[model samples]
Target: MSSLLDLHPMTRRSLLGGLAATGALVVLHPFAARAASNQAHLRLMETTDIHVNLMPYDYYADKPNDTLGLSRTASLIDGIRAEATNSMLIDNGDLLQGSPMGDYMAYKKGMKAGDLHPVMKAMNVLGYDCGTLGNHEFNYGLDFMFNTLAAAKHPIVCANLTKGQLASDPKNDELFFKPFVIIEKKIKDGAGHESPVKVGFIGFVPPQIMVWDAKNLEGKAQTRDIVEAARAWVPVMKEQGADIVIALSHSGIDAKGPSEKMENASLYLAGVEGIDAIFTGHQHLVFPGPKTWDGMQGVDAVKGTLMGKPAVMAGFWGSHMGLIDLLLEKDGKSWKIVDFTSEARPIYHRDEAKKIIADTKDKPEVVAAVQEEHEATLAYVRTPVGKTSAPLYSYFALVADDPSVQIVSNAQLWYIKDMLKETQYKDYPVLSAAAPFKAGGRGGADYYTDVPAGDIAIKNVSDLYLYPNTVQAVLITGAQVKNWLEMSAGMFNQIKPGSKDADLLNLDFPSYNYDVIDGVTYEIDLSEPAKYDKDGKEANPQANRIKNLSFNGKPIDPQQKFVVVTNNYRAGGGGKFPEIAGDKVIFVGPDTNRDVIVRYIISQGTINPSADGNWRFAALPGTTAVFQTGPKGRPFASKVIGAKIEDAGDGTEGFAKYRLIL
Candidate 1:
């Protein structure tokens, strides 16, 4: 149990002299000597939030993309492993869903018990050491999740996910999988001597999965809070023969303080004792980057350190790979991490012109593994679904209630209107809430959904709805409905009464969070401050952004009860929307929103891609707000009669500028 410096003086000198004779101790450095004899370097590599991107191609666009895919990341992994003598590759989940490939497998093909899911098949070829599930993994239901997990060549671990419902076993008493895994690796010490190192790897998923995927998980599985699960498992991992513990957290580092339902809780997991290093994801953000996390205690964003422990969160969709290098020193029979570094490796880098250049090439071997499935997926998505009478696009979704969002809401209301028959909620007026899934933000200009006017395919359907979330209806009061719309109004900037030109859309607010209630007529006054903040907190408590709210050509009563059709993510508190969660949920349907859209399109024979003009911006005299959108939207500018759209000029970041008279 002696430290490297605590070695007997005579023994140390003899060791140094022998090495000096062999020209192995050129500088006779104190730490270098200890490093050669007593230390081992362990490199931990991670790929997270991959979301079923196996190839370097965008299935939605049916084109190649250098910025995404696990095949490109495989090249980075090969290069990283070559630099380090000892390393382990792990995936932080959300890999089974997100793209057309995921839908092709889950909905179209349907996975059987023995079938190899494309994601797992690709991971098996890449040689993943182990992985943990993310919230999206449960999007398809428990049977599908386990069936896909069974195809993995490597072990799968999740400490937080468990079995049963909240009322019966809220504690998450029974684990759904092995809590943690102890890996025994033979590594070279500073002096080239080999030793067995016991590395403990544990994993955790956000507890909110129970709510986010309630339709899939409710009675079948439950989840414990990430921090609580870490507290219980880290000690058990230490009690075993584990020398060092690494957490593969399928959670993000939210600077926001601890919450039982915090979607991103990697920061809290790192503070738990006995955990040495951590790999994080699910926020789809890169850590150790320029973004500063202000109030998080013990978090060094620049150094990628949390609670003084090394941590990394790779950006989602295989855009970046997270790496943690650990310097371990042996103390008698155990090993302790003495030093470490963390960083994220991007697949592509943007030049001065903002053109993305591939930083890593696709690995041929990995591509060869998933080639069959990739071709099959492309074929599956290419199958024609129906025809659109007009173009289905989302270029102006943020500024106006466009066709892209309306079609989704139309389908939801159509489905729910029929579903409510004979049910208790049948008496209430049914409304639908839908949001634009793609509006060219972090996803770039090409991210917008732009299906042609003629034929529509399954891939087009995936572009319309990015997630696999099921349809859900929540019974809420009219007052609660106003608060909900107020939350959606947070997507706009507060325009001054006489301002000449101000930014209209709050780019920081994701377009997906800007829900447009289809059945209600309302106006969002940009001159007033947002009633809710971007995080859905009541930032301006007295501010009222929603105005002229009415239903069925009459002023709606605040005490009136209404059923609003929406996705599971929103109803289960994904956006933190007020009065839209918990017991407020009246019905949870098994059909995904995507399926609903498909059914609606088929039922109508030929769909009309037109907005109903249910919502608009309230006029503010002498003020105008400038916004940015794709140039393609210019042609459809006159179609929006609610707002005065003027072509301003060229905008930054390759967007076309437009001035909207509020």
Candidate 2:
């Protein structure tokens, strides 16, 4: 490794000047001795939003995945450490809750005090310097979270998360964890002067945690604003003899202006004074990329900087490892960042033939650290719960109301009816709202859920429902339900009334927002413009895309109220639908949606998977639209009702093209 003390910029410049003045060569021994003491390189390694992917094995699929897992990332970390003179590893949160392995650990294995969580054990084996908690860490409640954190060898910091109702006031609310940690690292300057650099790390989570995990957090804990927390803590860290400060922000970058409740506030957090560099995640996106930070002000995408300060966000699920290399120069008694570079290393990539292949070889030590948990998780997810009469897949979920979504709706309704019995809301009619989570967009063609007709295992339920969202009931008027459906209908591109073979299925619309509301029959008109824009703004006031909305055999009364059972994300304004969020919630169930599905399957013994044909596209003569989906859906394309679908050819990103005859 090249030491900073090997060469001094000024000494080398003076020597050249002296040589230029005199023809004869002149060497200054004193200048040469002081040359190597003036410069040093500091590397900051980060892993963000891992979501408990400790091993390469996918518990949900009951198979191995090359694209995910910290074991694979460990090899990359080892290689980087070998190349760098000085480096420190820090995880940027969301480490505890996403995969079925995490679910298995929390629900099945159960983490007791002093017990090591598989993720913590693996991270300990890898020797993490410090870590911060992401919003998902609170998904299993505080007790489980604290028990898991107890096993972590490194310090866990979170400045924003606090206890009690005084969360907004940081002074009054006691911090749930250490606000920040000052890590002392040794480095040599250009003059070969050795000194300790106190790198302060302060962490922040999204304030929206108070809303998303309301049931688990209410009256117990709350989260403060990210920017506000950083602004307050950075100054404190500076006063505590910290040479440099790094903001380990669990929030993502979304907007230029910072709000108290904004989910993506990393841009604003970076602007905080005294913060030298930043680590960002929670959007599951890559920074320093043209597509994500395109045209954004105060950002240098090529150099990976936010507000001219070094920053990086590794892709989620252990797909990438973020690295920030800082060129430090001594400023009197402390060190300041003179220059820096940031990049993320991926674990897998696609070849010319489009075959996904692993790049980083897995570290056996990391794999061995959690081998027992890995085997148990595999066993837990593979256990069969029930049998299905027909295949359950989501390839045609967005194009039509398929059996996959119908099963979710049926399970929610069945669970909610019993829970709401003998209550005041029991007298009102019940409805169910569900959306396809795996329709193959950014996740690629193989991401679609395809469960063959046979024994349904716990892993299949995890595949069916990717998120760990709890069930919640929202009470809304019939008019609001129609508005909700209209927002969902925006998934289709508007086609001219008589235009031939127009494009359908808006590529920008997320499949998770295209909800299918059960217990109501509706038809979407492709001829009209969308009522609302993708941001939920009223784009066209007079547009009427939703037609023939009826409940049972009669037309729905706009004033009549109905209770819709859906996941907490939808009920908490995740999709930004019209008049469906904020104060409309009537009940919040304690069980997760996955658990509900599991219980429903166990109760039924054998599930009859079939769509009720409650929704269809309105007739548009002489007009058609082309769509794309997974090629696996071609066999069942003819069996789907409401629209004519024909195989076209191969589509972009390994998907199959399909022509929707409207």
Estimate the TM-score of every prediction. 0.69, 0.69
Tell me the deviation in Å of residue 160 in model 1. Answer: 2.2
Residue 114 local lDDT, model 1: 94
Q: Write the per-residue lDDT of candidate 1 for residues 138-232, one digit (tens) a residue.
A: 87788888899998888888887776543343333678889899999898888788899998889888776655566676577777778887888
**True-vs-predicted CA distance for residue 490, candidate 2, Å:** 13
**What C-alpha lDDT, on a 0 to 100 scale, does residue 59 get in candidate 2?**
72
lDDT of 2 by residue, 155-190 (tens): 999988887665545645598889999999897655
Error of model 2, residue 58, in angstroms: 2.4
lDDT of 1: 0.80
